[model samples]
Target: MSKATTSKARILAAATAIAVEHGPKQLTLDNVAKKCGLSKGGLMHHFSSKEALLKSMTENMLHKLEEHGELLKTRHSDALTITNVIRTKKFINEIIGMNEAKILLVAAIENRELLSSVKAAMLEQKEAIMSEPKSEMATLLMLAADGLAFQELLGISPFDENERNQIGDKLIDMAIALEGDLHE
Candidate 1:
């Protein structure tokens, strides 16, 4: 990648880390600059304002997921819609850290345009998967999964490792059951 691309990537990565550790309310240009080892002037050259930076971060995340959507089209044989959503959540939890995700999610929601895009994607994905059968159940499954993640991220009844595992297993079971009902 070019130096500009690398620097932009660094800013996004650093912002994510800071947002995860602190809240989005705490995100600042100085903190992001220090984290990425860029001078304030350098950072400012790339992102002139915090709003711009947040917007870029949101787009960066969506672009990354779009890449995953492409990968899923090639790699998965069946149920790519639901599977990809589940896998994407898992990827976020593993790679981005849930706390960071929570902060980013909240921040993104505060941006009207960004929130609309997010909501549209959620609706589109759920509708696609629910088209199979037991559509309501599939929708419920999706909502429940999101709820668990958000709860964990927000420290609202945060789950222990075992609890997280158990919840995941239960979600899988729910998916399987829905599949059976749809096929029947």
Candidate 2:
């Protein structure tokens, strides 16, 4: 990546880390600049406003999903079994618990354009899932993942790695069992 790209990524990372540590309500461009070791003017050179930075963060979320989109398509085209689908669902659950998702939602609520863009992407993803045979189950998995992630971010859920893993395993098993029922 170019230096510009690297720096922008660093800024976004800094912003996300901060928002994840403190709710989005407390986030500010000055804080982000300090976190990135850049002057406020330099940060402005990259993103003229906090809204713009938040929008970038939202775009970053879609970029992440796109990273897995091709992989998911490939898996769907090949093997395409229920077990693989369950595994993918579990993976998404784990990803939602990640800091990235926390930042995405935080940014979206603070920036209207970011919220709209992210909502569009989410709608598209939902439509894609609806096109699949296991639409209902897939949608449920995604909703659960989103809810769990938000709860984790808000400290409403325990963030222990072991507990997360166990919950993931249970969710996957539940999906598999649901798939079996659909088959019958």
**Cα TM-score per model:** 0.82, 0.75
Compose the digit string of candidate 2's lDDT tens values, residues 1-184: 9989998999998998898888788679999999999999999999999988888887887676666655765765422233344455456656664677776667657755667877886687677667766778767876775566567666688657678677767766765665567657
lDDT of 1 by residue, 1-184 (tens): 9999999999988988888777777688999999999999999999998878887877676677677667755765445356556656665565655654554564665565655555677778877986766667767777888888878777775688578757866776667665556556
Predicted structure 2, TM vs. truth: 0.75
lDDT of candidate model 1 versus the reference: 0.72
- Each candidate's clash count: 1, 0
Candidate 2: segments with Cα more than 4 A from true spot:
72-97, 158-160, 174-184
Worst 10 residues of 1 by lDDT: 75-84
For model 2, give the 10-residue run with minimal summed lDDT. Answer: 77-86
Error of 2 at 14 (Å): 1.3
lDDT of each: 0.72, 0.72
Model 1 clash tally, residue pairs:
1
